[model samples]
Target: MVGARTLAHLAATAFLTVAGVVATPTTTHADESSDPDAVSAALWLATEVDDNGGIPGMVGTPDWGLTIDALIALEATGADAETAQEITAALKSHVRDYNSYDAWGVPGQRIAGATAKLLYAAVITDSDAEAFGSYDLRQETLDLVAGPELGLEEGRVKDKVDAPSVDSSNTFGQSLAVLGLSRSGGVPQSIVDFLIDQQCSVGGFRLYPYAFGGGTVTGDCDEQGADAVLDPDSTSMAVQALYAAAEHDSAGALEAADKGAAWLASIQREDGSFGGSGPTEASNTNSTGLAGQALRAAGETAAADRAAAWVLDHQLTSANAAAASAELGAIAYNGESLAAAQTDGIALFQRDQWRRATPQALLALADVSLGEIGLVDVDPGPVDPQPTPSTPGPGAGGPNGQLPATGAPVLPLAALGIGAAGAGLILLRLSRKESTS
Candidate 1:
């Protein structure tokens, strides 16, 4: 009889081929062990903040979504004080009036789900942790979890905006709320309890109690909608938020994390990459990154490494004429093609006195590799020494919880996918609709 893992591999292979995304061998034959170097590199890169103290989004812009994710990544990397302080400065600048109602707590751009993402950043960042813990953000925060009565199906925060009603329609928003409030030092246990009650059996989370039938999601593209179902991306983020809450308090949080981790592992491609479910499924770097993080947290280091390595390789090479002609120097996400020039530019970037990508890759690689060092027990030789970038990608949050949004204040959330920590990426309204990978 095929093992569960083997069965999952077969299913994933079928899924990928049917979905039309390439599942290359490099992405498949993953290095199964903890990548201490990768983790260190990614984490170290987190500390190399921009002048504004924020990680650069794909377009080299500062955005709150990246800010929150960057902070989370910084926390994971274990950055030092100087680095942490930069993160704090950025957070302090943007979080002053972090009303959940606004996009990045600002008006104009009503992003798909900025409310909870920014709030989560504020709750976790070093500067406003105390305020996050103590402030009566109930009116703003509670609306996502439940009605004041604390029910899952109905929420207190109703989006006044006509197009996207907030109340219960926004599960992503609600998940962020649960994570932010739970991680916030000051939030009451009642809030955590409310979110927990909504967990689904598949180890995934639902937007709201009634929004999805099982509290989690399943099925193909048609049924799930654009953001309808729970893929590794949303599931990992939701579980990470839950894990953060569990770490602070709650014995069951670990158990929930374990289940989520298992579910994520079960979905790993034969080569070790994880793809979001459905007819439109494509492997996502952000999802892979988060899944690797969740698995690492669950003590599945070998499995985590496999996923991490795949993510690293997915970084756009910027090679090839077609790729060279296209936008260059940006991180290749979702299997983006690089222009030959862009690829060359990245190569040049790599050759610089400070090699940015190499180190960033190393941090996550280290975390996964180190965690699995005992599992693999083989030394790959001396790692290439690379200087950190002048401005690192997201993941700049420090231990004290100080993480600034990318250096620019009030930038659009569309730049980076999301911040490093567990905050989801912002899906900018890009004209080109790439596959989810």
Candidate 2:
């Protein structure tokens, strides 16, 4: 309805600093050697992360959620290991803040997507997902799952708010939940079934889970009227999650995952790029990077490689960026963004676009798929039991001193379905190493 989505009401952040006051790392383009484009990208991300391990959003707010996305991207490429692990450790103190903001409706509201993502992060980071932060993320996810009593579709990971509210477990949340659980202890068939229910006959998945007609989340994607729009980002996430679920013997996961990947392939532009619905209608790196990962996960190697090529075209390589410019290796939001950067450089205000774009696009460049990702050496279990949390708790202090009202939509930067990924790649390697150990 409105413009794209919000991180600080909108996305991106500039190089090294925002206005000279913002502190960033000193690592430059020369830090990492191999995979120059991706290494430089990781270096740039490391600079953006503060000692506290937070990445500021549009308004210079501590973007706890986006920080996780950055860490996932960094780990996926196996670059900046120190910074990634340090930030992962730092986030333990801010778990309440991140969970509340990205997951929404904390204290009372137990949202599946929110909780699932936190579980996803904990699992990927190799933390005891069963005992992270103030809540047991794994248990929270299982508890919020919609049951036969809720009158909603069974096995669906729904948002459990205080009052009886509509299940807000969108396609993205459900997919992430499945991925998180797939590692924690295998996903349930009903969970897989609920995910399948969201896929349209055409193979694409919708964002809102159901196409509402009379204010209720009723009817299938095809049954809905003009409002029934398919989201590439959601479909991408679903495809990857389904691929993972398939390993656990979910009946329809493999079929649905393949169809979802096929639908994404069918919609790609001639340039091998994908775009999101609504404000992100143009082929952009965020959507394309996500789609590329899904394509590769589905074994659509050629399509994924093509998608990566399109994504590379948008990155600010050493050739395009000034030698001293901190923005080198950063990817643009789209062709228009690349042109703008080439014409006038990445403006200070436009940095958010670069920050948000780089991580996901870099993942595509890395050519890593989600279904195969396993854990790394993030170490498991909780950090030294956080301080006896204050009134609203740690991170509730926010960038200033306020939290988004309970039930805020998870529409901001990295917290969105698009930004939160990297499970498959890390899991692929770590889970295997874990087996041998």
Per-model lDDT: 0.40, 0.59
User: Lowest summed-lDDT stretch of 10 residues in model 1?
Assistant: 428-437
Error of 2 at 227 (Å): 4.0
lDDT of 2 by residue, 1-437 (tens): 00111122112433222221122212111221224455566667778987677766555755555666677666656667788788767767766564443344335544455566666667666688777755677777778676777454677777654333334456767787887777676676777777787778999987665553233554466666566778887788888788766654456777788788889989987877877665456667777788887787666778888877777777665555443244666766666667667678877676765676777676666545554443322121232111111111011111110111111122343232222222211011100000000
Q: Write the per-residue lDDT of candidate 1 for residues 347-433, one digit (tens) a residue.
A: 333221112222222323444211111122233334322322222122211111111111122333322223221121212222001
Q: Which stretches of candidate 2 lie over 4 Å from their true place?
A: 1-36, 101-106, 162-167, 212-215, 375-437
TM-score of each: 0.57, 0.74
- Candidate 1 residue-wise lDDT at 43: 43
Look at candidate 1 and tell me the lDDT of residue 284: 43
